[model samples]
Target: MKKNQSIYLFVVLLSGIVFTACNKLIGIGAPKNQLVTESVFKDTISIEAAVLGMYSKLANYNPGTDVGTATSLFNGLSADEGYYFPGTFYDDFKNNALTPTLYYIDGYWSNLYNVVYTANSIMEGAGAAALPEGYKNRVMAEAKFVRAVCYFYLVNEYGEVPLVLTTSVSESNVQPRDNVGKVYDQIEKDLTEAQAMLPSDLRYYGGNRTRATTWAAGALLARVYLFRGKWSQAGAAASTVIGNPGLFSMQPDAAKVFLANSQEGIMQFVNAIPSSWMATNLGASAAAVTPNFVLSDSLYAAFETGDARKANWVGIKVYGGKNYPYPAKYRYINGVGAVEHAQLLRMAEQYLIRAEARTQLGQFTDAAADLDVVRKRAGLGNTTANDKPTLIAAIEHECRTEFFCEWGHRWLDLKRWPGIANPAVTRADEVLGKEKGTLWQSTDMLYPVPQPARNVNVNLTQNAGYTN
Candidate 1:
């Protein structure tokens, strides 16, 4: 019943009947007890609650769960974004000591799969459910959006993974890992279908930004295509999101982006619960009690003297006789006044994606304009990157500084950037430095498939360079 653990801990499953009694815990709609799969989706409200429940699961990042601190904290530690105090339980990540049997590895893997299960459960009931045409399409689209996002993270983190798109236990159990390309293909198909069904006007349930919309679909597609090196598709998808100026626009103040219901949020998870893991780990609220992480020396030094991001977003505190910089993006830990919503997607990233995509397409002049939108927002001048190569490098640098500890954007970018054909594209290795005869290994690029998963499912294979 703890807030930090996955909602799966409270999920009750009986004879293909699934429901959660911990609905009060995460403040999402609860399923009727022992409700059959077909009956559960009969009502429009129930279907909407199911999608909201996925967001509740995604927000549980206090101590465990990969979607929360696992990505925001550990990813920052593993990448060049920040530093974690060595010798804690997190040392394995900061020290680059990842292995199949690592303590929290399976927690992340299970967390994501549990979400996929919920999405699949919703999708399976779509046809049988009694609902209006528009309502049914919206429900199915939102389910696919959540499912596709989870699968995207799964493929990027674990490389290849089982693609379970159904609720049939017999089918899901014996499946082997699919190739990354196949996984990406499924993600594209799901997102594309979802985009068509999503509400273009953002008529989200309860007038909350937490629910997925057409803009969310577009932003996710842009990110997916940009990572896959599909330039035209990436640019067009980003433009689709950016083109909707009424629903989306950059917050003129960089500090306002993380605020709940800020203008910059394209898709966000409402923290109905009082506690915020992002605030607890990064901001000034929990520093005096349990300050576990701080920004790395290199990251703090990456910002220019006049950069407003460094002045406003990055913060410093003296802990244990050493000066440590902590992330002040959230600035609020407890849910008292002005609750913090977990920012899943925002306007800033779409701009960066477009900039990178445009640079890749040899539109250097246009790329510089997009890059400046972010730079000027940070109280800086236009980029010096005039040519394609320099423009691409500038865009990459903007992504690193603009999005440091939000999601695993930096980590994902590091893995994807190496494959860019542009010689000027800054390689991840050139940026990720080594320490004491140890550098990030080729295998380190992808996480090991959790050992516990392989233990039960013999078909599941670990990624290269990790033992089963």
Candidate 2:
């Protein structure tokens, strides 16, 4: 048989396996069947298809269970950014009383691992294939970038997690949880390698912001470094992206930032369907109807009086003689008028990351300069903060107002920042305790490791607050 014919046969068999195994392996099984053999990677088209499939899964815009949507929704609720009014299972998150048995928790855990397993599969197949070295490098780099993103969220949400880097079911099924520091080490390694291999041209994705590039890797690395408290590295990484003005620049108009292929978007997910899940859920389709998910009073109040983001990114619906403010970042609820894409990384965030890193390093003047860039875009004046302590507080406030109800940035920030009055406690502890009254607990900082995941793998352990 010719090599091409044999490869075609393998593709046919793999398609069958994918459909049959997706359901069985979706949750704790990690979609082991989606792992393609090396023969499937022999051709460039097949290799591209494999990588595109991973993006499709990550970009799944379904309202429930998808990792991207769940991350924004549940985490928004878990923090003080929003409220869920239907009295559904999501209320647990709003109350900071998540359980291992919670439906969305299990869905989130399963979907995230699904992405990880797909990335591992791509790396293994690409490594073994007889493709050109450059092509193979690009494929492997993209896979590593995807895996790093999933692990970033996993470590943040679940604390210790099984660092499953291979597609072998036997290896993954019984893997034990690795510590937070170890997981972060792997994430940094993956991103560093990806940054070196990815194309620097923004148009490498054919003038679309959907795919990963050198800028995407650098932007994410800046965020990862900031979270890890590596001040200089974070600042440097962010500066690399900010310096590339031709490829990326902040949208002067806050309302235009979420539009498809906006100049501000470092990386985004082009909607698979015409509509966006964020818009459908957070935006009111009709004037009389209220969105079930509304922004919290505290978040609405966080915006300064003259901030452009408050005027442009928030939509208020008056129904039954009451006002409900919801996220207007994505305005196309049904995809009828203007197009919107799910923004994963943007230039504004890079400026904020650099500002925070600069503040922590005691470069107050430079940090304030970065902060003012975002402030000026929001139609606000330059920051009054001149010293390290005040600059840090100012940067934190900007992050809250700029990123609220977008991707759980507020939730993550609250957990990471020191309390205003007491440095000993996290801002989450101090803030949520006051916001949620008696409902908040310190252990709620990390969500429970989903019970179904624990059921399938005996080696998996529960987090501090949750019982079996």
Candidate 3:
């Protein structure tokens, strides 16, 4: 495993910072002209420079953005789509510590904040510069987009976190913890604002994949609202994208879906192409720990023999005499070498969110329609059971079976939705699967904030059940 040996990585959990306790507490709600003099950059052209800063943050933290390693822990932990990563270990993660390694909770923590800080700086700096009228607003919108994404990731990983909107270098950065609800609320607002500002005209011609777009902002808002149980908002946001949704769809073949050169991908980590990657499960050239990324038997059986998704998604191989169904769809980033880019938000998740949201809002028919769209793409015929309970079952089933082994959505999804109320688990009988080794998935949804971070940052507090 390539360690985050980069000097820039200083905190954890938030992705960019790696230091323990007494973290760099710069503060939030920064005014525009503090670090930046309003007169230096006085034109619209320079504003693009600031926006470039926003772009820089993503390029800085993403592994594909790295020089060598292309392992995808951030994507893996996102759930459902990925399997275990080797070589990397956090004490809290391994032992399921209520209070785990804050730094190692995930690099996304530091990586995200690093990006957020850069965004905040650019937004504030460019605004103060007053380069052009709409330029600052659009740039700030991009900052908000970055902020929303950071907070969204935080919410999914840990229930609640501090809402540090300003760069830590600012005096106001010392804001208290916002409840998970409020954090999400802010995320919604940020994305809403960003969606209005982002342009729909941009597209990547080369290997660039991380730039923000209206679809990304809109899709993220939908995901956040669905996560928070705001069904109507979720539906509205989802409709915006689904209304003119991208040409994304399942590869009639599941195996082709994970291939490096897949066409159906909506948003993926763009790597220098023609070459792909596969990080070692045990940090070896061969995936020792990942072990062919076997599909859960239950998930495999859910597909029919004729399902295009099944034939394309899973490969039945005997690794040392044990028959394992490996997810062949991720050949771009999962075998033999480093696939620099990791696909983050894909359109299929949107359909699940829409289907799940519709069910929560009691729009079963609409929900079933959304569910069927995904199912048909996966080559699964519509279910015979037309009832709400049965339809929900099928939807959740599709989510699990169709989306297995991309990253680690399965584990996190269980955390986010442990109870029946979660749209994914509408049926009384349906139970989403669990991790093979840990109850870490059950009692605690997130690994506790690392002990080191709390020791130094006096303002920072520990989670409810952790040992600080």
Across 1-468, the per-residue lDDT of candidate 1 in tens digits comes to: 453243333231221244242211111122344336676676765665565565666555224453765677778877877665433667677766688887678777777776777777777776578789888888889889998888988898889888988655445656789998999999999999999999877655555677788889989999999989999999999998998959779999877777777888888877643126676665556436435577777777778768889887877777678777778777665554356677888999998999998988899888899999999999999888998768766877788889888788888887777534533543555456443126566577778887776766778887887766
Worst 10 residues of 3 by lDDT: 13-22
lDDT of 3 by residue, 1-468 (tens): 123332122222212221121124332223333334353245654445445434544543444422112223333333333334332342233334534555454344445555566666666666677455665676677778877866676666666677777654443244445688888778888988888987663443243445566777888888788777788988887787766544445445444543433544544545533124332221222334234234455566777767877776565655566766655544443435335344556667787888888887788888888887777776777756466677656766777776554444554555555355555542211242343344333435454654544444456666666656
Q: What lDDT does model 1 reach?
A: 0.73
Ranking by TM-score: 2, 1, 3
Off by over 4 Å in 3: 1-56, 59-95, 170-174, 203-210, 245-264, 272-302, 315-317, 333-341, 421-442
User: Which runs of model 1 end up more than 4 angstroms from their true locations?
Assistant: 1-35, 61-63, 272-275, 284-290, 419-426, 433-439
Alpha carbon lDDT of residue 80, candidate 1? 76
- The alpha-carbon lDDT assigned to residue 6 of candidate 3 equals 25
Give the Cα lDDT of each candidate.
0.73, 0.82, 0.55
Tell me the lDDT of model 1 at 446: 79
For each candidate in turn, the TM-score is 0.89, 0.93, 0.75
Model 2 has a clash total of 0
